[model samples]
Target: MLELRPGCECCDRDLPPDSADARICTFECTFCVDCVDNVLRGVCPNCGGNFAPRPIRPASKLTNNPPSQKRTFNPDCFPASR
Candidate 1:
């Protein structure tokens, strides 16, 4: 299940679950559209991989499947040390 992160890690922009502006890398590193395209240049600053629009979790299931309580959003952690 997707954690449906609340905002961009770089700019701290609100990214509601249904937001079309949300982008995610393969490792689920979430960022805003502006950050993904302009600032990051389509390369995850942390992951070094391509990004895609994040999947929106249905609101109806909020009760059954709550969004993550994890408030941390550190893009620095997405890429594994090589």
Candidate 2:
């Protein structure tokens, strides 16, 4: 199952379970659309793989399969100016 991460790894932006802004690499490295387009240019910093829009879990299923509360912040993954 996808972790459905709670935030962007690069910018630390909030990405709720159903956010359309979430993007993830093959390795499940999550980031926001802003960071994926602007900072990463579709490339994942943690893995040299391309990113894809993260699938949103259905609201009904979220109760049993909760989204991950753990956040992964990696400012060094992108430029400091971001």
What lDDT would candidate 1 get against the real structure?
0.79
**Cα miss at 45, model 2 (Å)?**
0.4
| lDDT string, candidate 2, 1-82, tens digits | 9999899998899999999999999889999999999998888888789999999999999999999999999889876565
User: RMSD to native for every prediction?
Assistant: 4.9, 1.4
Please give the range of 10 consecutive residues that has the lowest summed lDDT in model 1.
73-82
The pairs that clash in candidate 1 are none
After superposing candidate 1, which stretches have Cα over 4 Å from the reference? Answer: 73-82
TM-score of 1: 0.80
For residues 1-82, what per-residue lDDT tens digits would candidate 1 score against the true structure?
Answer: 8887788887777887779999988887889998887777789877689999997777898889876655546655333441
Name the best candidate (by lDDT). Answer: 2
Evaluated at residue 13, the lDDT of candidate 2 is: 98
